[model samples]
Target: MRETVRWRNAVFAVFFAMGFGFASLAARFPTARDALDISVDQLGLALLGISIGSIAGLSTASHVVARLGTRAVVSVGVVVVGVGLAIAGWGVEARSMAVLVVGLVVTGLANGITDVAMNLSGAANERALAKPIMPIFHAFFSFGTVAGAGFGALGEATGLGMGPQMTIVLVAIGALSVVVRPRLVEQPIQPEDHVGFRERLSVWTDARTWLIGGLVLGMALTEGSANDWLALLMVDGHDFDPVGAALAFALFLTAMTAGRLAGVPLIERFGRVAMLRATGALAAVGLVLVIVVDDQVVALVGTALWGLGASLGFPIGMSAAADDARMATARVGAVATIGYVAFLAGPPMLGFLGEHLGLRDAMWVVLAFVLLSLATSAVAREPRTASGAPDPAAEVRP
Candidate 1:
């Protein structure tokens, strides 16, 4: 039990670090734009590098995990992420779009690999503990983002440039990676016959897997959209300054953190489907509020609601995909790959829309995805037993 606790804490640290690194980059989006002297559409096009690299990484994550184990993959991924951050910072400082795109692509690849490996570790921990803890782990991720964004905001307010800021964050994450390396859980080696590339990839043919992927896709859009563009929208659409915009983005992440922390018990009491439906409604209402209301206070409130609504979908999708433990890695890889379609497509699509309709208006696209997630929430039911029978006892709640 003590060992389990230690492992869990180690995984929490990893998630926190990942969130912190990503949010650090996110908070600097405006700076990158200004430094590079790029238009919104150009920025969006450049951001496509992340999508391209993330898709590549997601496609091959299961095989990497199978070969190298989660701990090693995560360790290597952290170093690569640091290198990517340094490169991105250099690009921003030098005002080179080509360099910036390369940096983003590299960062995205490392991030994608780290994402699957850490979630797999979290799922394994959940099985060992016999409880619903995935949301709590994700809450720590939100906490990390909050810290990173807040730090970036402070730096921005104080006149710190993007280059120095990212360098400091990268160094911190690299050190943390070393500290947490020893505590990660190690999976037993599987025989080659147990999980071939073909068999591992077979989850793609499962209808239920695609439904879960669809649900995750919507949630990913909801969350990824906010991560990539919320602050910029506030600045461009609402006439807010950069610091204020950063604070607003931080508020969204804080609300998300609170929602995830509060969701653990709610999920225990209500089951996954009911809670998802309620949150989906909250997200839709939130986005509507942001679109129609001009008042900053009202918009921020809507942002909070949107954050709460989106908090559960991605993490819950991961938990659902891992329900059949024997096939966890493969299923997780499939779900993550499908879900990332939103990340891959969101930036350029929204940028194009923002070019004509405005950023605020383009966000209405989020509503369509939210509704789709609500429609498919029922597919997230518990996994079946070995006899292929539904196991009520194995459901997320009682």
Candidate 2:
């Protein structure tokens, strides 16, 4: 149990670092845009680098973890994130879009590798505790985003540029990664659990996996759209300055943190499907308010709802994918690959649409996906035991 606790804490640190590193870059979207002097559509094209790299990483993460173990993949991936940030910062400072795209690709690939590894770690820990603690792990992630966004806002308010801000932040993340890597309790794959490559790939063909992936895709777009574009939306759609826009983005992250912190109890009571459906409704209403209300304060409120609604979808979907421990790694990787398409790739597509329709209206596409997730929420239900009772191990309680 003590080792389990340490392992969980290590996973938390990894999640936190990942969030902080990603948001440190995301919070500078406006600055990156201005620095590159690119149009919205052009910026979207550049963001495509992340999508391309993330897809590659997600598709291959299981193999990488199998070869290197979760501990090495996660630790090395975090360090790679720092390297990518350093390059991205230089690119922004140099005002070279090509350099920035290269940096983003590197960052996305590292993020993809770390994401699957950490979630696999978290799910394993959750099983050990015999409680629903995945959301708490994700809450720490949101906490990291809150801190990163706050720092970015402070840096912007103090007239610091993206290059210097990320330089200061990435060093801390790199150090944290070094410290936590050793604390991870690497779970060795048993011979009975070992599967051939073709067998591993078979999870991708499962209909239920795709259905869960669909749900994750919608919620991922909801959360990631904000991560990638909320600040810019505040500037372009709502007429806020860069500093104020960063604050609004911070506000969204804070709400997400709160929701995730509060999620385990709610999930323990209501179950994943109901929670997903309810959150989807809340996210849709929030999007409606943000798009149609035309009030900055209302937009801010809508942003909070959006964050709350998106808080659990990815984590819960991950938990569902890992319900069958024998196939956990493969299924999680497959689902993550599908979900990341929305998280990483969808934003650039939205940027192109925003160039034509306006940023506010492009959100309607996100809303459509949210509804799709809600409609497919049933797929997240826990699998029944052979005796027909809900699996006791899957019951998450205090």
Candidate 3:
């Protein structure tokens, strides 16, 4: 296989591993919590280690990209993530928060760095492919998520303990890390062109970027709210069991995966603006359906609708960042900083709102965000010129 193919495969694998890891923990969380005798508060604090490290890692991505090149950062991230799994697995046996934090931070940094590198690489690859392939590529991450979730059940069915199970998973991931190490290409990222670290840093001041960033923030907030609260909402509010409530989220993930995978060709044919506008409307309607109906079946369908509608959020936004010929790379960096914090902050904010207002009412908070997201996406200009050449403004306007 070509080096680039292998590199892309690694990208897919990295996301796949993250998905699987998330699933294993999700499946085993009840047992793990019982075994450790840890409260929700303690677990939250433990999880903070990963979140903190991911935030720190994301903040420094530009310098990392400039210095190490895309391939090295991603490869290092993959290796570090594997190390994290190793630590996390051992920590599970030892029941040590300190060890677990180490693993969390390692995996967090790995994921953070790899996220930036992969998106940039995928965007670059999109240019080479002369079509929109990025949406489908990001869908691989979604596939990993589903596979990992399902794998947890399979692991239990097979009577594989967490230690051996995690070890086997880590081994597979580590081998792939090494195999793809040499496949990544070191290209001068076009997105970073004509933008200095300082100027790139100044994306905070760009109104257009902020417009888009705010939109991204809203999407993440809504999605995070749903991810953290949906199952609980179904169970606590509607009196469903763990399995029944979980089915809602499972449907959401499936719908989201389908939407994003299908979004690829749609973007290529209709353009980003049209896709965003349409999807944005669909999400809005989905939220409304959930709000209006008290029926569980309809609400679950709303969840799927929300998923499908929200599917295009990040990839399409990144496409917009990379739309500018002169500053695609740097803008992506700037946009990422503003947008990523929402992932960290969203659930907490929604929880606070739910506490004050009501859980259902808190979802209404996301309605505002969703509307803002659609408006912000109006600035998602399509790329016309190939490189940073002075041309008709029409070329940059989508």
Best by TM-score: 2
TM-score, cand. 2: 0.97
Colliding pairs, model 3: 191-328, 191-329, 192-329
Per-residue alpha-carbon lDDT of candidate 2 for residues 194-251, written as tens digits (9 for 90 to 100): 8668888999889988998999999999998999888999999999899899999998
Q: Per-residue CA lDDT of candidate 1, range 172-290, in tens?
A: 98898888888887752232356888889899999988999999999999999999899899999888799898999999999899989988798878767888898899999999998
Q: TM-score of model 1 relative to the true fold?
A: 0.96
RMSD of 2: 1.7
For model 1, the superposed segments whose C-alpha errors exceed 4 Å read 188-193, 384-398
What does candidate 3's lDDT look like per residue over 289-356, in tens digits? Answer: 77667888888888889888878887777777766646665667667666766656654565566556
lDDT of 2: 0.86
Alpha-carbon local distance difference test for all models: 0.86, 0.86, 0.67
Q: How far off is residue 103 in model 2, in Å?
A: 0.6
- Answer with 2 or 3, whichever has the higher lDDT: 2
| Model 3 ranges off by over 4 Å | 1-10, 26-48, 85-102, 153-167, 188-196, 231-234, 245-247, 288-294, 353-361, 384-398
Q: For each candidate, how many residue pairs have backbone atoms clashing (under 3 Å)?
A: 0, 0, 3
The RMSD (Cα, Å) of candidate 3 is: 4.2
RMSD of each: 2.3, 1.7, 4.2
